[model samples]
Structures are given as C-alpha cells and as structure tokens.
Target: MEKPRKTAIFSQVPTLEEPRIDANILIRLLQVAIDRDFEAAEVALLKTLIQDPCLNFQAVADKTGYQMYYLRGQVGPRLWADFTEVFGRSYGAEIGKRNFGDFIHCFLEKLSLMPNSFLQQDLEQHQIAQIFEPGEGEWAIAPSESWFYGRSKELDSLGKLLSQYRLVTLIGDVGVGKTALAARWTERFGAKSFDRVIWKSIAHAPEPDILLNELLQEFEVKELPQKLSEKMSVLMQIIKRQRCLIVLDSAESLIRTTAITALDPYTSPDYGRMIRFFAEEPHQSSLLFISRRRFNDVLRLSRANRAAATMRLEGLQPKEAQRIFEAHGLKNSSDWQRLIQIYAGNPQYLISISEYIQTVFSGSVQEFLRCDTVIVPDIVCQEYITQIQEINAEHRALLFHLAALKDPVHFDQLVVNLATSMKSQSALIKALNDLTEMNLVEKQQNNAILFGLNPIVKKVILSFPFIGGS
Candidate 1:
C-alpha cells in the first residue's frame, strides 16, 4: 500500500469565505486572546492586515515602518506562541505574515460559534484584571507635582465631592494651583478610588469631535459613532458601567469670558452638550473640570443637580506658601508671612517670586521685600495680558480702573470711576461679575461688598504698556 500523504498545516483547516471584520474588533479579539495589549507596531500590523491579507512580511514592514527582521523574528514568534495557547495548535500552526488575515478570519468565525456568555465572561474578567492591577490606569497628561505643599482641606474636599457628585468643576485664578491640586489628588487616590484616571488639557483648543473621538479610543470602545450625539451616548454607557475619574485641565480655553455663555463659538456645541449629559445623567464616574472661569452651564446645572458641584480654588494658605519659600532656599523666615500676604499665597506667583529672590536678592526675603514694588514674573504677566485681551473693551477698562485703586472700592464707586468708559450701570455690574468670574478681581465683604485687584495682578496691569496709562 502507498504511504498516506501527510496533510499540510494550512490545508487541514477548511477554508471559509473571509468575512470583513472591523479593525477595532480584530484588535479586541487579539487583545483578548493574548491576555494583554499590543505595542504600536503589533497594532499597526493588525490594522494593515485588514486592508490586504496577502501582504508578505516585507510589505507589512514597508507599510508599518517596522523593520522586516523585527516583524518576522521577534513579533512573529511571540504572536504564534500566544495564539497557540489561546486557540488549538492546528489554528496557530502556520500564522505567517501572508496568511495572518486568514488566521484572524478563521479565529473570529470560531469565536462566533462559542457561547456568548463565555466570551462575555472572559472579556469581563480581562477588564477586571486590568482595573485591579496596581499602578495601571492613570493617564497623567497634566504636569507632575514638582514640589507640592499643603492642601489637606482641599484634597479632603475633593475626595468628598467626587464621592457625592459625578461632575465637579475646580475653578480658580490662573496660577492658583488648580492643575497641581488635580494632579496631586489623582496621584494619591486615583488607583484606589476608580477604575481609570484620565487627565487631558485643552490648552491647544482641540475641536469637540476630535476630543470625543480621542476619549472614546482611550476607553477602548470597539466602535465609535460618526455623530457626536451617538458618541456621547456610548461614552455615558461606559462611564455608567465603569468607575472613572476624568480631569479636563485648562478648561477656560473653551469657555467665553466676555459673555455669560458657557463656551465660545470656537468650541463646538457638542462639548457643552456632553458636559450637560455628564452632569445630568446618573453615573458612577466623576468629571473634574479645571478652569480659570466657571462656565454658565456648570453654574446653572450645579444649582439644579446634586450631582454637579463647583469649587472655587483660592490661593494657598500662609503655612503652605511658606514651604515654597523654604524650597527656594530663601532666608528671613520672619518676613515670609509678609511676602506670602503680598503675593496672596498664590503658589505659582510665590514660586516665581521665590526664585527671583534667590537669583536677584541672594536668597534674602527681606531684601526682596525691601524693593517695595510688586514683582510680577514675565510668564505671569503674559498670562494676565492674554486673559485681558480676551475680554471686551468695557471689561478691560474696568480692570484698569481696579488696578488704579488704593483700596477695595464699593460698587457705587466703581460705577463713578468707570462712568465715562461704561455708561450703563447694568453693563458695569456685568463687567464686575465677569472679572470676578475670571478671578482677576477679589471681592471683600466687610460692612459692604468691595472689589479690588490682587496686588500682583494690579502690578501686572500697571506695568503692561498697552493698558498701563489708558
């Protein structure tokens, strides 16, 4: 009798019509099978395979910008072993570059035949494992804490607010440590309190659609919708099921300071809608918005809903401000309190002032104070100038008038001071409210309500050439 011919590894499995699987679906399958995430190169290879299954290793390397040797040697062998452990040896036997798509299609078809509960359970378990893994889920795109000092009360307050509310807005002046506080809180309690911690800064002013798409991808959504409405719905579903803490820093970039409207036209309406949904919808997640000025919608929603809250961050306490001076190696501890008071305990201003003292006054706080003039750093001045430019001419005039004040003045006094520049009392009141919202003017409630600029802010305004003498 003739010897029976051995069947080839690729020929043993019956060929089925290759179904077109979404790249994201294939990526999810691969992630599940391997019990881990893919590096950029591996993900690129898989995405490329969806377009052309018959491409060789060289072709994949050319498209993906990965070396052919790296793909064929290190990547190929590891994938083969990983697939073999998940699928049987027959399915994993001949998974080369040319037949990679065939393998994926066959595996997916087999997966479709498996019980739905089994697949769901596996996926759930995988996600749970990822969540519980130590130091796993923090995506800290915000700046790190260089030298964080006391905010014990604020930190505790944040914890309590996050527990009770789904949306919390941390509003403050430009350099009042809002970003630092958010970052530090995330560093301390993020892993323990939530499944994932995501930090994003919109300082560059990304479009709402682009931002939503990026966030959906971050959550590993299998299919993203083309419409913003659908995307918000899907995101709400994910947050409802999974405990998440998301921080949007530099939120003022999207808000309008000149008007009571929550956002400027540069930002899409969808962004505001998304914020409303997060605030209104019941979910087990928290969205923290850090902005210099509070949004009108946030204010409105916060009043109506217990799930939304806003915290107006102020300058650090005298004790906390002392630490910054100490870290800068400044002398004259006796005068530290005076220095802190002058700077209003603003962390960034203190840090900049401390460094200036260290550089110019030989680390002597007394010497720096003796100069008897508010020393606004260039960076801080530029920030103030930028903010001033965004406001209307009436608001700018009001700020300049405030800068000229010898002491906090009453509302009536402001009207008289700005009578020529602003003829309408309602417009003057509106301007004061806008400036207060921007944290540029401080409100003092003594026998009467009085408004004045922080010494540092007044100094910056007076020194600013364009508006100095106006």
Candidate 2:
C-alpha cells in the first residue's frame, strides 16, 4: 500500500516569467486592512499568471511539477472561488480567457477612485500630524455620542464582571468599540460603582513608573513609595480603602512580546507585579483593561481560573449596523444587508464606509454594492493592518493556513497540515493558541471542537497577493 500525496493547494501555479504589472504593485493592491503574511504556493502561481496570463492549469501544473489532477481538482477551484468572492466578478473566467492583466488594470483604476486612495496619495505627498495626546479624566475618555445604540446585553455581562471580578479585561480587534464601551460603562456607573474613578491611556506606551506616579498623584499620596514593592503595597491599600475603579486604555502595551518565557510577568515588571497583586490579594477595588490583544498575565488571573474576568467584543448586530446607516442619512436597500455582512458589522468600518458612500456615491448603497469592492477607509484600515502585521511570522503563517482551509478543521488535521511545513508540534500548538487569544480563530461549540478562521479574517487573507516576486 502507498500513502497518498498531499501537495499545497496554492503551490500548483508557477512563478511568472514576465509579469504585465509590477509584482510590487500587485502586492500593494492585495495588502488591505486585514493584511496577512504571503502564502508561498499562491504567490508562485500568481507570479506565473502575471508573466503569462494565457497559461492554463495544465501549463501551471507542468511548470510546478505537480500532478494536473491535484492542481486542477484541489487548488484551481478554491483559488477561483476566492477570487470571485473578493473581486465580485467571474475572475476565473477572465483568467481562462487571458484577460487577467486587463482585469488587474481596471481594478487598480477603480481602487484609485476609492476614498482610501485619496488619503494614501496625500500621505505619500505629506507628513501626518501627531494627535495622540495623553487622555485625562473619565469624561475625556468617554464616548462623545449622547446615545449609544445596541450593547445592552453586553452591559449586563460587563456589570457582572465588575461586581464579581477584581480585574476585568475588554478585548477585541481594532476599532471594535472597546474603548467606547469601557468609557460609557465607567461614565454611567462611575460614582455608584466605586468611590473614585480614574482613566488613563497607554496609547503612547508610558513607562510603568510614569503610570504609577500619575495614579499616585491622583490619589494625593503625600508620601510616595520609594520601591516598586512599596508602590504596589500603597496602590493596593488605596484601592482597598477607596474602592477605586481604574480604567487603563490600550493595556496591550503592558504585554511583552519579546518575553523570554511565557510564565514571566508582562514586559513591564512593575506593571506585571501590580496586576498580579491586584488580582491575587484581597481588595475592594476593580481594574478594567481595554485592549486589542489580551496579555498572558491578565488571562492567567482571569475569573475563568477564579481570578479575573474578560469580555471579548464582536461586531455589531444587523440592527445596530442599520442604526449607523440611518445616522449617515442613507436609504436602505438589499445591498445594505450585504454591505453589513461584508464589513462584519464593525462599527467604525460601517461609519467609514457609510461616509465614503455619502460623499462619493451620493449615499447610494446600491451603487456602492454594484461596484463590489472592499472599501475600508485609510484610518480604519491602518488600525487593523498594524495589529495583524504585528504578530510573529510563525503565528501569522498558522493563521494563513487556517484561513486557507475554507472549512472547519479538527486539531488533528491542523497538526498534520502544519507538520507538512516542518513546524514542530509544540510550536504549532503555541501558534494555534496565540491565534485563539487574538480571537482570529474560533472553536466550534460542539464537543468535537473544530476550529475555523472568522469570515472577515478569511476575506482579508484571500485579498493578499498570492505572488512572491514583490
């Protein structure tokens, strides 16, 4: 008996001998808001097609030294389907007819018309102004909108976390409204929930000493603690005595991605000691951390382990997205529903796109949908793209593999697929766990416990250039 061969799904395509468009240009085009690491197999195939658009699957298969059966049956269909979904066209048919270069030209031309491109062009010609001033007071941090739609149910759960847990973390992807929700929660119940409320933003990555001193100043401690240990003791005493509620925005700064060991405290030893003491020791006060990524130290102490608590935010419900659309004074159409789905109900993304449509397409959701392009504004795109690109290469590659699966996969399947790329089992598990922590991958609720990439994440991964020449 012989074992079955398993070639990579994207490796069937050959590298381009002479590309029509600059490979770098194509690469830049694919790097959207949800950018991920390039896939080698796909990149090779794409490069080949860019050089010789008329080459069919058989030619690609021959060039790559892969069986035509494997290339055509497994790789070609998935590739075509992904292109169709992203480009909103019969991309596969165009490729077959050797009109791929023409399609690329037209797509790039339309991309230039998008609002994001306008910003990009300006950025290329000018320097951006820095506007991230240190935030002060709960009022300064709170959502400016007088009315917040949706999140009623989330508020209830949040209330529970605040009441029961010593430490609570609000985690979500960029622009998922974590800060708005945190600020609103604090503003609504600040006085009643605790004796004192304090808000601070770590957006500028302040040092642990600076953060501690600022809080101490707020506490009006006449005698400052000279040592880190003494500072933690003093902080704990204040928290217990005053029943304070501390809100730390962008808490991901405390995370040390360069840590030598997983068990080690977060990058800032002082901050790590502070959170540990807050979670472990008895105290009347609570701390709320809002961040795009969850820190290992925080999770270790979360209520799941009978220590702290965490709330992971998802996109808004359809009705909530509708509120955004209505706010923008846009009329509803069938395309409205699809638009919401395409952006995964991200509030910031919805607002940005709605404004883009209003300003550029005369508030016509139908016209925008007919164009069939993912049009995330430069501001929101930069936010998400930075977060995605920050992940280490190995973990990122794991995510790319998950995205390529296109279906729910079991742990064993992932292990086998990952091993084919020569990743160690332990490393593979670590990468998978990292993805889980970021909420990029979800485990099915069923007992079987299959895993799959979130739909929006998958779309972003597919949008990246599949070619490597760039």
Best by lDDT: 1
> lDDT (CA) for every model shown?
0.73, 0.63
In model 2, what lDDT does residue 100 have? 46
The lDDT of model 1 is 0.73
Candidate 1 lDDT trough over 10 residues, lowest sum: 3-12
Candidate 2 lDDT by residue in tens digits, 251-337: 876665434436663666667777777898998888889987776677777634657877898889999888877756666565688
Which runs in model 1 stand beyond 4 Å of their true positions?
Answer: 1-142, 259-266, 467-470
| lDDT digits (tens) for residues 250-299 of candidate 1 | 88888765554523532566677778888998889999988888877777
Query: How large is the C-alpha RMSD of every model relative to the true structure?
Result: 16.9, 20.7
lDDT at 157, model 2: 82
Per candidate, the number of residue pairs that clash is 0, 9
Segments of candidate 2 deviating more than 4 angstroms: 1-147, 258-261, 303-307, 401-417, 420-422, 442-470
Give me candidate 1's TM-score against the actual structure: 0.69
Name the weakest run of 10 consecutive residues (lDDT summed) in model 2: 125-134
lDDT of 2: 0.63
Question: Model 1 clash pairs?
Answer: none
